[model samples]
Target: MFARVAQEDFSQQALYDELCAHDQRSRAGAIVTFTGRVRDYNHAGAIDGIELEYYPGMTEQALAQLIDKAVKRFSLTNAGIVHRVGRLANHEQIVWVGTCAAHRQDAFLAASFLMDMLKQSVPIWKKEWVGEQAHWVAAKGSDDDAAMRWLTEDKDS
Candidate 1:
């Protein structure tokens, strides 16, 4: 199976429903989901909103490849990823990932792998509105470390 990537408005219920529907169609025994939300604060303090930027086709392609790797590595039955673009308010959802597999371990690992890879490899960038100023948020080194662990595991295996 291949990966799926979508740019959408911040909507938790919609994503939850989509995930539930995907899970229902599966013969797998387990499903795992991860949702990322816009927080009220950042390193700069209170945040009013955030604007996400991406390279359109390139971003989607990169995300799809990341998901494909996760699916293959973990033997996932199904996977869905949705990332919100444009301006988003505090407490709104920013991203979601769902994975279905025959066992809990595969489902869990796939879901984690998708998120970690997205954070590290995906080209989507964010500009945050904090009070009167806006700034671009840099990708965290910790995220890269997390993603690299999987690569190391793959090399070892």
Candidate 2:
């Protein structure tokens, strides 16, 4: 399952509980969860806050395809991703991913894959509000390199 919200807040405990509840009936032995939070600092300057914008239908479709790829590549039993949009304050939750698999390795790999792919392929754009100015954040080459690691190499290698 996948969900995206344009709200101002989310509950970490609630999300964790929901992920576990949804995967309880599965025969998987391992589950991995990842949560990303907004920090106060960026390379350019100190960010007071951030506003995320996404192309509604296209963004969701791309993310779903990414998740499907991760599931197929890592042999995951279940996977869930939630990304929050709109204005976000420092220390606020930005994204979450949960993966379940019969083995720990697959679960871990799937979780990593989801994050990396989301960073690279998702159509979400962030505008950082620093002091009294706002600037559009550009995608870093480092992120492309990180995502390429998974796309170009096999895990065992």
User: After superposition, which runs of candidate 1 have C-alpha atoms over 4 Å from their true positions?
Assistant: 1-26, 154-157
lDDT of each: 0.77, 0.84
lDDT digits (tens) for residues 42-136 of candidate 2 = 98667898999999888888888888898889888788888889988898989988888899999998898889879898999999998778899
Clashing pairs in 1: none
- Candidate 2: the clashing residue pairs are none
Clashes of each: 0, 0
Give lDDT tens digits, candidate 1, residues 1-157: 3333445554657665676676576688887888888888876578898988888888888878877887777877777788878888897878878888889988888888888778888888899997777899988889889888877785223
Off by over 4 Å in 2: none
